[model samples]
Target chain A: MECKLIRPADLDEALAAREQYTHDALPIAGGQSLLVMMRNRLVAPAALIDLEPIEALRGVEVSSAGISIGAMNTCRQLIASPVLGEEVGVLPVAARQVSSTAVRNLGTIGGNVCHNEPGADLPPALLALNARAAVRRRANAREVPLAEFFTGYFETVLEPDEILCRIDIEHPPAGAAGVYLKHAISPEDLAMVGVAAVVVPDGKQTGGVAEVRIGIGGAAPVPLRAARTEAALKGAVLDAETARAAGETAATEVDPPSDPHAGADYRRKMVSVFVRRALLQAARQIEENGHGAA
Target chain B: MALLELKVNGQEVRVEAPDTALLLDVLRERLALTGAKRGCETSHCGCCTVRVDGMAVHSCVVLAVRCEGKAIATVEGCGDGMELDRLQRLFLEHGAVQCGYCGPGMLMAAQALLEQNPAPTLDEVKKGLDGNLCRCTGYTPIFDAILAYGRGE
Candidate 1:
């Protein structure tokens, strides 16, 4: 069967096409992974709604509340975005590490989040930043937190009739530092275990963190926050011992899958190692820069 | 079928292809410009790498219809008609080609990188060509070629 291409001029037309096609169509953002999936015979949609023509789905905007990132902004755009570099620096850092240069040239943040592929680099960083997905239908819209976005492997909470318009992220707390660490055999391969840590220091107590958020990927069925680990480290002074304990606790929070790249036990072990490294590095970054600006 | 108006090698040409046809298929099959090789259709291999609007992208995963108005540059566009370009000459001098399967893609990827960064470090050169793999030369010669080109040698 020949698949059809539907190019909509605006968001309204896109939503209407999405509503009209529903399950028979799939929205292609960047087509980085979707086209490969189509070639592999994993998905065969009757129509592909091209989101490239919709101007509303393209740019990065900043308001008093936070940053609004359009769904169509490619990874290259994210890397070159000075606003993202100043506000959420970890996104550009992660964006640089997405895939090869060619793939990152066209791959997008919204597509990465919606694809929900295990071992992807964006989710952990986005999750740690507490990003929210802005989704729209024909006549309505809603926001889904990054934490609750992924349902399972290669799956998200996105409905057939809805299109993810943008991602919204509030500014990180003052004096907070974020770090993303990926454990992949090669630079281009997906991480065996990817860890992102955002640490906010306590102004009143020296060496103590007021709060800590840890987002992990490729370690479970879905990218998730280590809530138990976060709770354990809240208000605690960060040290080698404390970071080690936090890493151990995070390891207990996930059930990693075994595959050709790694065994379940190996991946579980890497989670602990990388989590500790990421947390310590983030702390060191704060010490060096006097803030989480990096 | 869709009628695509493309600017390839700075030439305005019209080609009719399937709505969902890949840019690689259109260039290789219909237009007969086979400089971009079809390696792993999955995009892991950069054999199908091309420049869309001056950005390096794997043509195998790009839809032909999507590239309608974009400037597409393949290996065929790298040099003057009858003579080898500087980068191609450097590749030969550096002995970068072994089996030559990855030659065109490497040239395209290298050309794109050089255009972006007139002078790229060895690490930057490696990262720029990370998507391409050459089972033959172990990449040392390719790296040497790009570095030499950056040095204006």
Candidate 2:
């Protein structure tokens, strides 16, 4: 299909394209994903609403609340944002591990999640922290919990006319410690199994477990919540034994998908391995690093 | 069709092409900057590496429209005549290049590494060039070339 390139300078111009062209128009932020898909013939639209001209969509703002990462912010930007990095180093650490320098410079964090690749690094990390995804539909804007944003494999709940304006990560929750671990088959391909674990300590705990959130992907169709693992460890004291149990629970709970990249067994096994490593990693980070989001 | 005005090497050229135009296409077809070759139309091969605003990116995967309002540097722009850039000269001196098809992309990738980290360790150099594939297995000299040039040692 023939397509036209449309550059939108403001929210009004972007919304105008949405109202008039609808599905034919897609908001292009960074163009790293859309351009590649278009080139590969996997995705084609009749028109593109390039968002880079909208300066409002470019800067990274850190506040007392958390980090508000703009839609057009590239991985390069995130890697260089000292404020965000110090507040949330997990983001840049994950961004740098995504692919390579060339790809990282072009790929945007918004595009990474917005594309909703099941094996993507940010989704699991974002979900692990319960990051809120802010979507703009015309004149209205709403924040959707990350868990609800993804509906299925290669699918998102985002309306065709709406665009993900930015991703609002809540200030590292008190005692929040996070890490992203994945089984990468190669430097270029997506994860065979990715696990992100964030531990939000339940302070004043007398006996057992600190609160923890574990998110695992590439094993399942959508990046999934490790509810069983979270349940097993919650209110229970975290020890080597408890961490081990949580890892096993995560592996057993998530229904891993099979593909050319990895078998179901491999993905499932990695669920146990990566989640455990991620948990321990997060635990160590909290203990050694002191409080997060200072 | 899309009308884009971009600075190729150092000169600004205006051209009308399809929205699907790759930076490689714009450089090779319209503005006559062909030093950046197109290897794999897909990004699997790094034959199309170029500097967009100073970081190396795959021109094959990059949209030409994105190049507008940004500085683009190709191997052709690095230096005049055969003098080449330091990395380029080092690559030849170290015998890093073989067959010469992947040379442009290799040089671009190496140049990016040196610019950001002039003293990358061997592992860092290896990590930096992970995206660029050299089919001839000429990596030893390539690694040596990058390390030597980056440190001026």
Per-residue CA lDDT of model 2 for B68-148, tens digit only, reads 899998988877866676778888898988888888988888888888898999999998887788888468989999889
Error of 2 at A21 (Å): 1.6
Question: Tens digits of per-residue lDDT for model 2 on A227-261?
Answer: 88998887876656677778888989888888888
User: Can you write out model 1's per-residue Cα lDDT over A1-294, one digit (the tens) per residue?
Assistant: 999999999999999999999999999999999999999999999999999999999999999899999999999999999999998988888888898999999899989999989999999999999999999999899999989999999999999999999999998998889899999999899888999999999867656899999999999999999999999999999889999999999999999999999999999999999999999998898888778763
Which residue runs of candidate 1 sit more than 4 Å off their true CA positions? none
Best by TM-score: 1
Steric clash pairs (candidate 2): A208-A236, A208-A237, A209-A236, A209-A237, A219-A256
List the candidates' TM-scores in order. Answer: 0.99, 0.94
Residue B110 of model 1: what lDDT?
A: 90
